[model samples]
Target: MIYLNQAGYAPNSTKRATITGNNHYNLFSADGKKILSGECTLEFDENSGENAAVIDFSEVTEEGRYFFADEDNFRSPEFVISKNHYDQALRDSMKMFYFQRCGMELEEKYAGVYKRKACHCGGGYILGDRFQRRKMLGGWHDAGDYGRYVTAGAVALAHLLYGYEMFPGALTLNLNIPESGGSLPDILAECKYELDWILDMQDEDGGVHHKCTSASFCGFIMPDEDDLDMVITPVSSLATADFVAIMALASRIYHKFDEPYSNTLAAAARKSWTWLIKNPSFIFENPKEVTTGTYEDLCDADERFWAAAEMYRLDKNEDAMKVILGTMELHLSMHCLGWADVAGLGTLSIINSGTDFFGKDLYNRLVMKWLDEADRLKLISQSNAFGITLRPIEFTWGSNMVILMNAMILCVAHKLTGDDSYLKSAQYQLDYIFGRNAMDLSYVTGIGERAFKHPHLRPTAADNIDAPIPGFVSGGPNFRPCDEAANPDNMSDVPAMKRYADDVRSYSTNEITIYWNSPLVFVLGYMNSL
Candidate 1:
């Protein structure tokens, strides 16, 4: 399979690039006639091997259907060079969050092709402290498992909120969710659905429980069918901190749409923030009996930073702003936005929060710091064969989220600096994920000609349909293939970019998660605006 941008590209945008060892290639009309032929320039990287082929279709300004072809491979899927190549993709990606909703019936009227049974309705209990049973009804099922984890859900929801915050104009596409034509944007409405679930996960004292899951992973069955010992586990400072950040953010955004809900969220945010402040070092350890994704965070500094930064945004507490600023100074460097580490979220909230809480000069300094970091990643991406930012060392679990987050950083930088290079790099990152990389597969479901079909997601496994749910991005290539679904013979010695297997058993490379799909929605939304 040859990878092109599955969302297509604009005629005036950056030249399209793809990986191919072959020396000759052709651009074909939709009718299978060669319109242009050229000798390929083989760029090589010691780390990523031979760079992909680059195609400059910028001169083809006529808006019409086209594709790529070579002597060795079959014809590529038809793509269009129009002004709105990414609009529908942005819509579908946002709808994925709706498909992931738990404890709610996916009625056929709203969720057309992705409807399913209601699940996880029964509340749960603390594992060791089983006597402390709490009502845990809502939120998304994390990854392929039928579990709802606070830290993981917070990260996904925060990223989705960031997307909405940064690109509100672009994300206004109607997703036909249950609240489709409501006053709130469809993206926010979908997020609010999960946010409501998140609210339910919180205890009376505002220390959010770490996760709600069965003692062991459920069988590869539908969510409604998974009937194990569902229990809500212990609360932790990390979960509370992450919860505070998301709630504060939700409170701010939801205020314009639903003031009463917004007020409730704000109160919850304050309570969670207070809980974290009082118990700063209350780390979370998975109870012995439970064996789900622990999402354990040993250090709470990033979570603390994020929570305080968000609280500053909502209420502007002087002490919270001071602590957030100090935390920013201490950790000037940013890591990939993930469930465990959230310093980047703290940093982004500060940059976009519109409050010169640290003074104008300090805020300017912070923006410069962020743009500089993004520039560093851009340089690496620009130098790579496929123009992807991730290095071989970065291909750990959930690598797709890291790659998408890198693109998101580029998008944020573009918004801040008006640098075309940043936007161009982000586009290339999208291209890489969709099909332009070594694997020659679109990581998203039901998009490319050779898109991911078998994800580790339970609904996909249980559904009668042949394809997985559309627009759900898979956990891309991982160097350490550690899941039971991982086929050792196919992955043991492959290159970093080539390590992905489309097989359903390859959980490390094939599972779908909200965090992975969230940035995809953000990036697609941004690209549609472009």
Candidate 2:
């Protein structure tokens, strides 16, 4: 029978008892491949014995075919039920993963740049860490077209996980938006427009030449930051680019799911993939992402890689999993010793796979690695090493991003390994977050150590908790929460709850980020769906 995709795994071992007459079972396929387990004389009897109480012996004398068992469901063997429990457990995880998305907020956008009335200008789709940083004295500082591009890409991802993807919400595929959402010819025109504007802006080598550009869509000028410049370089690996690419790819993925336009998406996939592959910010040593960096500022490269695994499943290319698995192994092997959580991102897609190394052991190792890093000093990455070495609050966003993700990872690990310790560790990390965040979703503006709230600021594409952020008014955002000497006046602030005014959360961050929102959604969805 066609069982739901869930309920596949089952107890592997079962004892076969002889029914006095029939001890044969045959399995056949429509095409004609049939299997017979030969003939073995029945042995044990279920009548009037220790086993008699456990099994029914009423049909003891019948000599005929019995029942059979498959992956998700079975008929004969009572011993094989345990194997399927894991699948049930995984489905239940949807509870946590689904709830995670609730944190994301939609950002209204404007069609044109330079709106005199910033408030009444236009509406944006979603807000991510991309827009949270560049605050200027006169207005909300923007990184220009790059910012818009980043948003466009991120919103796509948000929608993808919000249940728009054709494949499972993993493989990071994308679409090249048409120039205009019009007729077929007009669609081509729109495609040309987007391609011309975005592609032309890149240098001959396919990278943004200027770190800071003007935003035609938002009417603002972007700031030139050192790291932003470092990322577009062909030689270095960056987390920022990968994270932003999620938006574009996710948008296309969602659209494809909505319409089943396989060929159209395939056509648009190349350039975007090219951009991701060639970008320096994303470390790809050993044919996988290797180098690790600030979790907050840089876009994660592996996020797309993780998304690709699910894509392979949907396309049934099976070959694609080779790309997904091989590259991921390369990353995991290279990243195992590092404390940066960015590397762990590559492990996400592998969690549900059934390969030799990936089925179990490898997952456990990753959780252990993250725990070691979070628990120790040298193991911690530069971004997470705040409040002590490495600029105190530099990676406030990154640090928490690492912690929250690792927690989810730990929870999954616990289920797979049957180890409660891992779950304990996951809970600890969540508690670690509450230590500062007040367990509240609002950190908008008027909130603080206990009353931090910044609801007014817009939410970005990546969930703020998971993505890089410059942070709010409290004290830390750009690597440091309270970078006194570096930024004497700079401080991170907690955002207030805009939606739940009566339930004003004293610990929430200001805006909801897409990346941050995705993980939360994933954790709850994975947990609750079970």
Candidate 3:
């Protein structure tokens, strides 16, 4: 079988595919006319423990639909080589957030066949005090569940707003959401839905709730069908700090369109900054009775650094700058742009602020650190058969997000330095998500010839639609299958790359999260802009 990007490739991009045993390959047009032929070079893939015949057809730059045929009679899925190859996928991925919106009726005009009534619209009671109800009406559902979490939502927003900031041209398309004709771009408008909810999560004291969820996970049912009581979890330093960072960033982005709302965000950010400074070590844990997702973190240093960095970027506050300088080494050492560790996001904000804010010496240092990480990821991609930056141990839960995030880092490196190598590495990572893996599966739903269909999302499972909602990214390939549904028939013993089950019961591997899709949007937005 040929493993390549089923979503296709950009015409001038490096086009490569891997076959298990075939040593020769031919690229054919839609009508079976041969366009290019190449001899495959054999490479040992450590993840799959197989010798892969790698096909490199980078010379095929014409805009047309094509496929590969191997000597062993295996024909690859048809894919397009065009400048607009990623346009549909990018739009679908962005529209995914609109589909995930809570507390609002999804009109048929916007949602089409997936349209549904408003869900979870009732005000949520404070977890410890049932009598105290707060209006928690909007925001995208955090993941496969109906929960809304601050840390996750903030990280997801960072990906999106940063994408808009860096590539405004790509994200300016009309997504046909309710805010389609608004003054702000549709991307920022869609994000404001969640931003409003995030603001509501902040208490009078400025601390933000960790999450708003039921006491436990509900059965698989439509969002409106599930009658579970929503409870607002207690505030944590992590949530507060993340809230500060994202609110600060959003304030800047929304300032041009809505100065009043932007000022509200800035005020909210400052309040949260105060809360973070006062309650510096407040880490949240799930109360004994609550059985929902915890999102508990052991340390809040990175969150504080990110919050401080954003606050600094917002107004050049000296206190925030002092915090950034104090945590500069720790921020530089951190490599991940995940929910748990967001110092990288803070670094990005600082880097984007330019050397005028931070001295030239410090700016150069940060640039060097980013380039060095990109260089390391490039080497890792070269060493692998799929040309992705995942090590064997890195194929844990939510591994697909890791792939996209690595691609995001490579994209940033490309922008920092005009080296085409970084961009190529980023494209390879996108290719892996589209197909180009041992499973021959596109990790995104409804996007490719063999996209994964069953996501662990409750609404999709209960919608009765034959296909899951489009553009929600699957977690992908967890070596340690935590659920019995994922480990059926001793499937956990398979190679890490093939350990994925398409079962909706396999939440560890098959679940889709807002943050996961956000990076996909960022990467796709960047590619489309190019």
lDDT winner: 3
Residue 60 error, candidate 1, Å: 1.7
Q: Name the TM-score of candidate 1.
A: 0.95
lDDT of 1 at 122: 72
Better of 1 and 3 by lDDT: 3
Q: How would the candidate models be sorted by TM-score, starting from the highest?
A: 3, 1, 2
State model 2's lDDT: 0.30
Superpose all Cα atoms of candidate 2 onto the true structure and report the RMSD in Å to 1 decimal.
19.8
Worst 10 residues of 2 by lDDT: 46-55
After the best TM-score superposition of candidate 2, give how far the Cα of residue 394 lies from its true spot, in angstroms.
9.3
Tens digit of per-residue lDDT, candidate 3, span 1-530 = 78999899878889888877777888899999999887767777877657786677889899899988888889888899988888889999999999999999999999989999999988799987999998899999999999999999999999999898898899898999999998989999999999999999998889899899889999999888868999998899999999999999999999989999999999999998988888856868877778888889988888988898899888888888888777876644545699988888987887888887877876787778888889999999988778889887788899999999999999999988889999989998988899999988989898888899989999888989998888889999887878877874687457888888888999988999999999999999988888
| TM-score (C-alpha, index-matched) for candidate 3 | 0.98
The per-prediction CA RMSD against the true structure, in angstroms, equals 1.9, 19.8, 1.3
Q: What is residue 43's positional error in candidate 3, in angstroms?
A: 2.6
Q: How high is each candidate's TM-score?
A: 0.95, 0.39, 0.98
Q: Which RMSD does model 3 reach against the true structure? A: 1.3
Cα lDDT tens digits, model 2, 1-530, are: 11011111222211122222343333322233443333334333211111110111222222222233233333332111232332322222221111111112212231111111222112221112243222111111211112323222232233224322212432221211212234322212222223222332233333321212222223122121111211111222232333323323433444533344333333333334455455534442211111211123233434444434444433434543454555545544312211222334344334434445344565565555544543443223111201111223323433344444555555555555665555444433332332212123212221112323332222222123322222222211233322222231322232110111211121121223324433333333333333
Candidates ranked, most accurate by lDDT first: 3, 1, 2
Name the candidate, 2 or 3, with the larger lDDT value: 3
Per-residue lDDT of model 1, residues 110-135, tens digit only:
87766788887777877777677666
